[model samples]
Target: MGEVEIRPPRPEEYAVAGEVTVLAYQADGHLADGVGYDATLRDVARRVEAAEVLVAVDRAGDVVGTVTIVQPGSEYAEISRPGELEFRMLAVAPSARGRGIGDALVGAVFDRARALGLRRVVLSSLDRMHSAHRLYERLGFARLAERDWRPFPHVMLIAYQIDV
Candidate 1:
């Protein structure tokens, strides 16, 4: 383990986005549904370069953790409330957990939000991700609500919001 690299991703790196997503949520039997096309990956890289996404890669260049912060107008932001930035995805690859990477990613979001003049942030997570709940709480993200919605049946989900 050398110096960990935290930086904007390149367009070619989007392929790893799909792989990482699949790996991160594999415990729940989640798989990619053909949604991560080339365009999506390119957009992800663009966002990464714009400070809209924070990705943590190991010294050898594998993406271990990733977080996306969306401004009020970004597509993934469904929260209609005012002055809110949606923390779209905060995923730390299973192999990289327990190393405080999640904590560092959230800290990066905090600094980013302050720099962008955003005061609030929110994200959705599955209820089964109990460890994630603990991590968010430890980082001062409080539970605002929980609901069941989207891609399948019996998928209980939670919404966490925080003022940064």
Candidate 2:
């Protein structure tokens, strides 16, 4: 991998970008084989229409990571308030992990929030995603325990936030 470009994916790359997101989640054990949520994760087209979807493409233009930025009223936003931006479905290909791709993706989220003049950025993560929690903390996000909630049975999501 040479330089990575973080930007909205080209329309032709939607399927591949969606597949990369699903692969990353499955590889990380955050998503199970044959789960219905896989469909949601792979629906990049829907996300593109409802929010800002960004991809981290390698020098060869292959998408290795992706994330969705959701405004307050979007269907994907779990806990964003007025004057805040929320991001969801952050994923980086397993082969591309440990290369600062995740950091870059989250950084891009902050950039988006700032560019939009939002006062903060928020996100939710599963408890099992310890590594992701570390990344968020390293990026100055604080735990928002009060905002934690379970979106589904047997699955609890924790919240984190950072003021821009």
Candidate 3:
């Protein structure tokens, strides 16, 4: 209901951003308690240090969503290749859904890629994340079926890429 700003999280806001990420993932059934992936999603400080962590804040200056953008060769990079940028761990607060915060955060990644003269933006998502898949499609991301991977048994990660 108010203006939203997309920017890097301040040091003091890391904890809040991590909490928002955890809550958003849990509320969406994207995470389970006591899972190793849950801890990864809750580690905003680590991501901020290893990659670019962006947060969306409302007029009240509360973090409503967040995403982590990783460059090629970065420690957190999973799907990006040379000449491409990758992002992961996109989360929008449950209460903040449908407000375009997710789109704004993603757009920020595209902006960054363009500024860096990258050819494309890439990411990986779980198969069950249909909502996120739709958003990616709407933003011109194409399925990279050959690049789909499975990090753990029975857990497939679908890949997508968009030319920027």
- Quantify all predictions' global Cα lDDT against the true fold: 0.68, 0.90, 0.90
| 1-164 per-residue lDDT for model 2 (tens digits) | 24688999998989999999889888878875334888988899999988999999998778999999999988888998899999999999988889899989998998999999999999999889898999999999999999999877778899999998
TM-score of 2: 0.95
When 1 and 3 are scored with TM-score, the better candidate is 3
Clashes of each: 0, 0, 0
State TM-scores per candidate. 0.77, 0.95, 0.95
For candidate 3, which ten residues in a row score worst on lDDT?
27-36
lDDT of 2: 0.90
lDDT for model 3 comes to: 0.90
User: What digit string (tens of lDDT, one per residue) describes model 3 on residues 55-117?
Assistant: 999999899999999998899988889999999999999998998898899999999999999
Per-residue lDDT for 121 in model 2?
A: 95
Ten-residue region with minimum lDDT total, candidate 2: 26-35
